[model samples]
Target: MGSRVEEVPNKQVILKDYSSGFQKESDLLVKSGSIKLKVPEESSNAVVLVKNLYLSCDPAMGVLMRGVPVPGFIYPYKPGSPIYGYGVAKVIDSRHPNFKKGDLVWGMTAWEEYTLIPKPESLIKIEHTDIPLSYYTGLLGMAGLTAYAGYFEVSSPKKGERVFVSAASEAVGQLVGQFAKLLGCYVVGSAGSKEKVDLLKNRLGFDEAFDYKEEPDLEVRIDVYFDNVGGKMLDAVLLNMRIRGRITACGMISQYNLQQPEGVHNLMNIILRQIRMGGFTADNYLHLYPKFLEKLLPHIRKGEIIYIEDVARGLENGPRALMGLFSGRNFGKQLVEVACE
Candidate 1:
């Protein structure tokens, strides 16, 4: 007789309920479940079982937790189920031909100790492992692609042009600022706290950085604007854009939690200034991954680009880390460290 597949206990972060207003840490509950170690023979489709290492706590996850149906390729997290997001994992068992045991990969995975990916095609195998594996959750993964596509593809920037970034301390925004600087543009960034602003100017190589909370009036006119925080910040950037300026809308973190999202009042400025505005999601530009790696790998190796992360250890702290994004409690990219190696 064949031996039975061993089932192991799995710790997971589960969504307790949907939130329309501000998301609280209590909304997520850490629960323990069990999973089989190997792919079941009776499985109808290709599946890969993986052990998660790190999980990314992005602002987009906040929108998903709200349980509101937004028009996108992604969907909202369901209550009573384990929440999932971008994470770095190691394949322990696989029925998919592309993946095998001991392969490191990153993509959408359940917020658990172990996950069974029914659609393993979404996962990307990790080709380069010389750098930190956790980087796959942010830099060299989702955020990197987003920043590269938004600035180079959507913004259509030119050398010596002035550039502005909102929420400049976050993962994507921080990178956008650095990219603008490398292109010889005069880069300015707006962050929530004085410490973050200092990090932007002193550490991240932005030409200038300001505490947006301190200076609500953003009067600087720029040729390119990277919009991360929408609502009032977007409205301000709209008014200050130079003629024929380009605005790349990457995210709207400010308006994600509100019951009624605040409206932008200065949209007419886009017409007046002949501004070209475009929004993008990284999934649309997956073909450019190799090209992005070619451009970014050198800067990373030479220390020209700096990526910071605020890591929350353990699965239990996942809720707190994810919620910190909305309050600006995290200094950099917020992520959860589920396991080591």
Candidate 2:
């Protein structure tokens, strides 16, 4: 006879209420819950039971915290339920054919110890274990794809192009800067603090980096702009864009927490400079994942590309780590380590 599957307690980071203005740590509550170890018979055969290991903390999550409806197909998190985000997990049980027990995966998951993913299509199986498993939450996950698509596909970067990245120390921005460097572009990045600026220039290999808070004037004109921190920084970059510049609007982190988003004054420069600006989501570029991996994996293996992560241990600290992103408190890619594999 086969052994019976057991039910276990699940610790979850629950959203207490919808955010109004800026989000506070108080908006989230870590609570204990319980779940069956096996997928229910009535559940969809596609469902997979995952034991989450790491959870990503992104600025975009703040937008979901707000009760307001968002443009596009994004659904807001329910106030009383566990918040969901990109995460790395181990498959505990699977009714799906593509995955089986003990397979590592990364995708949209609840901020809980265990999650039953209804649609397993979004989950990508982790084939390479040579790199840190946590990277699937950042570098090897959505953030990396965002940088690849934004830089290569959207901006259509060319060698010798002068490139600029805003919020260059963050997950996607860091990768974008590295990608530009690898492309032989003169890359300059703007960071929030001296430490982050140093990381961009000294560690991440940006040709030049500056603390935007200290130097609000983006002194030089550039041919490409990878915008992660939008708002005044974006407004400043607008005035400095060289003619025919390409701007990939990857994110607007600065505006996420604002009650009223800041308006840009230099939008007219787009017309005067004949600049091209476009926004993208990683989901739109998933078709290129295999191609992206083929390119990125070699760089990673050869030490041509490096990634940094700031890990917050335990699910209880998840809220604080998430809130830290807005305050520039997290040093690198902020993630919560829920369990060890």
lDDT of each: 0.90, 0.91
Q: Scored by Cα lDDT, where does model 2 land?
A: 0.91
lDDT (Cα, tens digit) per residue for candidate 2, span 1-341:
26577989999999999987888899999999999899888897899999999999988788888865444225888999999889999999999999999999998999999999999988999999998999999999989998999999999899999999998989899999999999999999988899999999889999999998899887888999999988998898899999999889988988887889999999999999999998888889889999999999999999899998999999999999999999999998999999988
After TM-score superposition, the amount by which residue 331's alpha carbon in candidate 1 deviates from its true location, in angstroms, is 1.1
Cα deviation of 199, candidate 1, in Å: 0.5
Model 2, position 210, has a per-residue lDDT of 93
Clashes of each: 0, 0
Q: Cα deviation in Å at residue 55, candidate 1?
A: 0.5
**Cα RMSD to native, each candidate?**
1.3, 1.6
